[model samples]
Target: MAIKYIPYFKDAIQGQALLDNFVRTKRILKYADNNEVKERIERGLPLYETEVTEIVGKESDNLVIRGECISACAYLKENNIKVDLVYIDPPFASGADYAKTVYIRRNPRIEETIKKAEEKLEIEDLKTFEEKMYGDIWNKEAYLNWMYENLMAIKSIMSEIASIYVHLDWHICHYVKILMDEIFGEDNFKNEIIWHYSWGSRIETQWNKKHDTLYMYSKSEKFYFNANEVLEERIISEKTKNRLKYKGAMITDRNKGRGDQEKALPTDVWYIATINGMAMEKVDYSTQKPEALLERIIKASSNKNMIVADFFGGSGVTAKVANDLGRKFIHCDIGINSIETTRDRLKETGASFKIMDIKDGVNLYRNPIQTMDKIKSLIPGLKNEDSVSEFWEGAINDSKLGLVPVYVPNLMDSSTKLLDIVLINKVINLAIPELPDEIKKVIIYYIDIIDKKEINDFIKENLGREIEIELRDLKEILSETVVDDVLEYRILNNEIVIDSFVSDRIIRKINEYNEKMKAQFIVKGGKTKFIEISEEGLELIEMVSLDCTSDKGIWHSDEEIKINKLGYTIENGIKTKKFWDGKIKFLKRPLRIKIRNISGDEIIFNVI
Candidate 1:
C-alpha cells in the first residue's frame, strides 16, 4: 500500500518557494524540539552540543566524531567550529547495499598446517564473508529532504571563505545539486567537477559508469581557490614545443619562454585512477575515495594549518590527506566501522585528534542498519501485517486494542529519529487516517522526543480521530547485553602469547553463513561445503594489541599487529607482508590486551 503521510515539501513547494519557506520560517528541519529551537533562537544559544568520548594522542584541533552528519554539523555550528574547506563523499543513493569483505585471518597457532598449505592457499581459498557497512537505498522525496537539511546544517557552520566539494555519483547528484543551490545560494556556485576513473564493471548494453561528480560551492562570493597549489605537470608535444620555441617572447606574457616541463592548472575534469586491489592506500572500505582526489581538492581550496572538515568521512581519506597536507581536519560518520577505520588510519599517521560522539541518543548499536535489523525481534508481538502500509514497520496484537499498527522511525534517516511536532502532525493528519477502520490503536516508537508532555497534548488536540495513540520509547526495549569474547593468553618471558581466541559473534555469523549456503545447495541438489574453524579460532581475531603502559582510561597500543584481507600482517604501523607470529614481544610487563574480531567488534582483557 502507498504511504499516506504527506512530505513537508510537497509538489507545491518548488524552487524559490522551497528556499523561501526555509528562509522565512527558519525551519531548517532537524531532530530537535520546537521549544528548544525557539529558546535557542531567542537566547542565541547553540542548538546542539558534542560529547567527547576519547582523546587520542596529544590534544590538538583535529576531531573524529562518531555520529550522523546533520548532528555533527549541528555540534560544529553550536561550537562555532568553522572550517576553511569541506569535502564530503556521502552515499550516492545508488540503491545498492555496500559491504566490507570480512576476511578470516590466518591462524598463527597452526604453524604446521600453514607451512604445509602455504603454496596451495590462493586469495580465493581464504575464508571471507561480506559484512554490510551501510545501505544507500532512499526514496526520492525523502532523499531530497534529508539532503536539504544536511546542506542547510553544513552551510551554517562554514566560514565565509570556506569551499565545499560534494562528491556524488549519477544516482542522485542532479537532485542534490538543486538542494545545494537553494541552501548555499546559486551565486556561490563554483564548478561541477567530473572525477574520471577507470575501474568499474563494464556492460554491453550501455556505456560504463566509471566517473563521479563533484559539485564545488563556496560559502560566500569571496572564497579561497589556489590553482598553483594543485597545478598539474603539462604534457608537452614536440610540435607545441617547437612552436613555443619559435614564438619565444611572442607567446602570452604568462607563458612567455615557458619550459617544456611546465606546470599548468588542472581542469575541472580530473583523471585520477581509482584505488585498485593491492594498493597500499586501499583500506577495504566500500566507499573510500582515492587520496589523490582529496589531495587535489584540499590543496586547491585550502591552505596549510587551515581546518578541513568531512562530514561523510568514509575510511577517513579526507582526514588523512588533510593531515598529510599539514592541515587540521574534522572527520565525522555514523558507522562504527568508519570511525574505527578512520581512527586506526589516523593513528598510523600519528595525528592528534579528539574523538567525539554527538549527544543524539541513537547510539544503541554499531550503526543504524544493524540496529534496524535487530529491532524487529526486540519488540514483542510486532509482526508483519499485510494490511498495513510499508511506512508502518508492522502490527502488534494487543489484547485490549486488537491489531495495532506500529510506526518505527527509520534509524538510517536522521530526520525520523526525533519525534517532534512536524512528525506528530504527519502521523495525525496523514498516517493514522489511512489505517484500516478495524484498527483501534496505533503505536509510534521514538528514539528521542522533544517533549513528551507537549507531544502527548498536541496529539490529543490534533488527532481528531478516535484512535488510541501510544508513544513507545524505542530505547526502552533496546537494552543490550554485552557478550565478551573468550580469550586464552599469558605472559611468558616478557612475551604475550595468545593461545586461543573465540568471538561469539563471529561463530554465530559463520554458522549463519553455512546454513544459508547449505540451503542454497539443497535447492540446487548438491552438497554444500562448510567453513571449518579450528578449535583455537585464532583466525577470527583481526588485530591483537598489548598495552604494556596503561591499565585504565585511554588505551595505548604499545605493540600491535593487524591482519589485512590477504592474510598479511601490519605490525606496529608497518606492513610486513608476513603472517602474524601469534605472539607480542613486549619491552615492559603487559597490563592489558585488546583483541578485535574480523567484523570490527573489539574486546579487552585485563592481564593478571
Candidate 2:
C-alpha cells in the first residue's frame, strides 16, 4: 500500500479562515431553545443557559458544571463568572481510546472462604474490565474547528488580568498554538512551557515522546504572574558556598538581595513526574495529571481566593489543587465520569460547590461513549448493515416502509449531536443522495433540535428525492426505563443496616466479561474460571451515604462510607486502614439513602 502524503499543517489556512469568520460573525447555536440560536446571538442574548442540578456542600462560589466547555464558557460569560486563571487539558487528538479500569468491590460475604483458603484478596482476585470514558480520535480539520470554538469561548470568559494554559501534546499542540495566537492576540502570547515527564512507553523507532506542551496566553497585556509564589528550591554547589563563605557575603547578597536564599524562580521548562499508580492521590483516571503540575501553574498565575477555571477537567486535579491553594474554582467537562470523579474528589477537600448542567440535550447517559455503545440496543429493530454508508448507523427492517436506514449521530462529535438546518441540509445534499433507491425512508436520531417544523420544511423544499424523513428524539429513547440497582436496607435503632445491594449493570457486565474470557480461554486451550458473585451481592456497592437532613431536592451526605479497591474504608472523607464492616450508623433519623455502585452509578431511595 502506498502512503498518502498529507501535510501536518494541511488545515492551517482554512482553520484560520473559519476562526476569523466565527470571530467576525459572532453567530451561536442554541439548541435548547428550539430556535435558530444565531437569531438570539444577533439580538444580543445569551447563547446558552445553564441550570444548577445539585448544590454540593454549603453555598459557595465554586462550581462543577457537567456540560460542553463552549456552552459552559458562554453561560459563565453571560452570568459574569470571570476567572483570573484557566488551565485546560483537552484531548490531544491522538488516535487512541482512553478507558478506566472498572474493578469489582471486595465481597465481604466471602471473607470466610478467603480466610479458609489462606489467601488475601488482591486486585488480581477482583474481576476488572475496561470501560471506555472517551475517544481522542478526530479528523484534523474537525478537531481544529472544535478547538477554535472552545478557545474563543474560554477567552470570552477570561478576566482582563487572566492567563490560560492550553495543555496539549506533540500531536496537535502546534496547530492549536496558531489558533491561540489568532484568538488571543499574538502580542498577548506569553510562554510555551514544556512539561517534561519520563513515565511513558519508550519507542525504539524514534525518540520517546515524554513531554507535553502548555501554551500560555493572556487575555491582555496586564496578566498575573507571581514568581515568588511558584519559586523552586535551588541547590547551591559546594564551591559556590565556599566562595560565598570566604567573601563573607550576606545571606541577602547570596540570594540576589532576596530574604529567601533556597528558592528560585521556575523556568519555562518544567520537570514534574506523572502520577504514580500507587500514589494516594491517584484516582484511576486515564489522563489525570499530578497535583504538583497544577500547583505551580495555579500559584504563579493566580492569587489566594482568586477564581481558577479548568474547562477540560479530566480527573479534577486542577480543581483539587486550586482549592488546596485557597483559590475558588470552576471545573467543567462533558463526561459524566469526569463530573463524578471531580465531585467526589472535591468532596474530600470539604469545598462547597454547585453542580450545574447546561440545558443542552447531551445529558442522556454517563457519557457520550457509553451512550453510543448503548444506542444500538436502545433503538428498536436497529441492526448492523454492512452495505450502507458509514454515515448511517444501521438499517432497520420496516414492516411497510421496507429497509429504513437509521442515522444515529456520533455523540463523541458535538457537531452531529444537534439537528439544525445546516445538518439537515448536509443530510439532504450529501447523505441522502448516496442512499440506495430501495430505501424509501430514513430515520434520523437527534439529541437536540433547532426546530422540527423548520427542519421538516427545509427537507421538503431542498430534498429532490421522494423519501420519508423521520426525525426521532434520541434523548427520549435513551431516557426510557433505565434499570437501577436494587438496595435492601432497614433502620435498626440508630444504625441503618444495608442488608444487601445488587447492581443489574454490574451483574450484566460481569456475565459478559466471563463469556468473553471463556471464549478466549477456549481458543487458547486453557482452563477458565468464571467470576462468581454472592447471592446477596453486597460487593457491588462502593459507597453508601445517608442524607438525614432532607428527603427531597439536593443531596447532603450527612453520614457516608466508601470502600476503596483495596478493601480499606473511608468514612466521611477520612480514610481508615480498616476494611468496611457493611454497617452504616447515622446521627439522626435518615430521610434518604444514597448508594453508589463501583462503576459510579448512584441510586437514591427515600426512607419509607
Candidate 3:
C-alpha cells in the first residue's frame, strides 16, 4: 500500500518499513459502546451514576469524567453532550516521565493550621517524595494509534459547529496533523497556531525550540469563531506617531482611531508566558499549560454557556479558563493526579462540577465480580455450582483478598497430595461428584504476586480443616493476578477511624525487585517505609481530607489526615507523641473525604 504522509527521521525506518509497523498493531476502538453511547446521550439519560463527586465547589451540576478519553468521549456521545469546543494537550511523545513532587509535613498538627502553613512553604523547605505523574514515552506507531482512537472518539460527540485545539510540541504535531485531517476532513482544517513562550531550556547543539503548536480543526466548514472577541490591538505605527501636523488634525493615517485599532485581530501566532514556579495558578505539576493560552482558545471557539471539554486535562487550565469565561466544561483524564489537580484548581474558581470515574483504577483486572467465574473454570474438580457460589460469598466479605476464596475439598485417595495438583482444566460441565476418585484433591489457590504474607495468613487460618488449601501466586502459576488495595476506615460518633490499608500492588513490586536484585529497596524493608508509587495507585496516597457535611463537591471544613508509622508533635520545646501510629481525629459527621495519594490520585467518597 502506498503511504499518504509520514514524517521521515534521519537513519530511521521509512515508507513501507514504517507502514508495516503501524499495521501490525490492531486499532483500539473507543472503550464505550458507540451505539449505546449515542442512544443515552441523545435520550438525555444520565451517562454516569456514581453520585457526581464535586472536587471543590458547592455542587457543580457540570461534569468532570475521569478515565481514558475514549471512554469519556463515548459517554459524552451516549448522553448527547455536544461539546462546542475541545482542547487536548496530550502527550507530546517526549521521552520523559513527568513527575510531581509531593511533600510530607513534619510534626502532627491541625488541618486548618497545616493548610495555612503549607501556603508559605517552599519546595525545598519540605521533605519531598517524587511520584510519576504521567509517562510520555511512546514509539511512533503506538503514539499515532493512541492519538487516532481518541480523535475519532472526540469527533463523534462534537457539536456541528464545534472546534478542536490540539496543543502539541514539534515532536508529534506533524503526524497528528495528518491524523486530524482524516478525522475532521482536510476542508475543516484551520490554523496551526504557534504558542510562543520564553524560558525554555537552551541547548548548545540546536537553537532553542521555544514554541508549541496548537492545531485547530472544526467539525464543519462553517464553525463558531469570535475573532473580534479574541483580537489584540496593534501597536501604533511609527509613521502615524512621527507624522507632522497638517491643520487641526495631525498628518497621520486616518484609520488610526482608538476604537479602529482595537478592532485588529490577533494573528495565529500568540505570545503567552509559561506558568512559572511561583505563579499563583501553578499547582506544582509539571507540563502545566498557562491560563492565558487556554483563555484565547476558549474565548475564540466557544460562546458563554456553551459546553467545552479537555480530554487530556493536564493541570486543568482549559477547564478553569472555560468555567471562568462562563462556559460549562467537561474535563477527562486517565491520570489520577490530573483529576486531583484540576479538581482542586477548579474548586478555587468555585465552578460547580461533578467528578465521574469511567474506569475503576483500584479495580482493574482485580474486580471480584468479573474474575471469579474465570477463576472457577481454572480449578480442577471445583466446577460445581455450590463451589462457585461459596467463592462469591467469601470474596465479598474477605478482608485481604476481597475475592471469593477458592474452595478446596479433601481428597479420597491416600497418595493424592493437594500441593502437587495443578489447576489447569477447562470446563466440561461435569458435576463435582462425577469426577474420578484420584482427582479428589481440590486445592483453592489465590494467584497473587505481592500479597504472600496476606495469602499465608489466610492459609494458616484455614489450616487443620477438612478441605486442603494452598497459596499460589503469579510466580508459581500463570493464573490472573488480583490487587486488593483498599483503605479500611470507619466513622462513628463524628470521628474518623482508619483501621488498616492494603497496598498489595506496591508491596508486590517491591518484593519482585528485592528477589531479582541484591540491592535492598526502602519499600522492600517492610510497611514501616512510606508506601509511594509512580503514576496512580495506593502509594500515591498522601493526605485524606474530610468535609463533615458536603453533598456538593466542595470542602467547607476539612480535617487533613496523613498516615505515618511514627509521628510526633512539638509543644513548649518538648516533642511528644501526638499520634501513636498516624492516628488522626476528625470531629465531623456525614463526611465527604478526599484521599490524595503521592502521585496526586484522589478518591472523594462520602461516609454518611
Runs in model 1 lying further than 4 Å from the true structure: 1-17, 20-54, 116-120, 239-261
- Candidate 2: Cα lDDT at 17: 20
Ranking according to TM-score, highest score first: 2, 1, 3
Best by lDDT: 2
Who is ahead in lDDT, 1 or 2?
2
Q: What is the lDDT of candidate 1?
A: 0.76
lDDT of 1 by residue, 392-451 (tens): 999989898799999999988876776777788878877877888888899899987777
Question: Judged by TM-score relative to the true structure, which candidate is superior, 1 or 3?
Answer: 1
Give the Å shift of residue 590 in candidate 1: 4.0
Name the best candidate (by TM-score).
2
- How much is the lDDT of residue 248 in candidate 2? 21
Reference-based lDDT, each prediction? 0.76, 0.77, 0.55
Candidates 1 and 2 compared by TM-score, better number: 2
TM-score of every candidate: 0.87, 0.88, 0.58
| Model 2 TM-score, 2 decimals | 0.88
Worst 10 residues of 2 by lDDT: 1-10
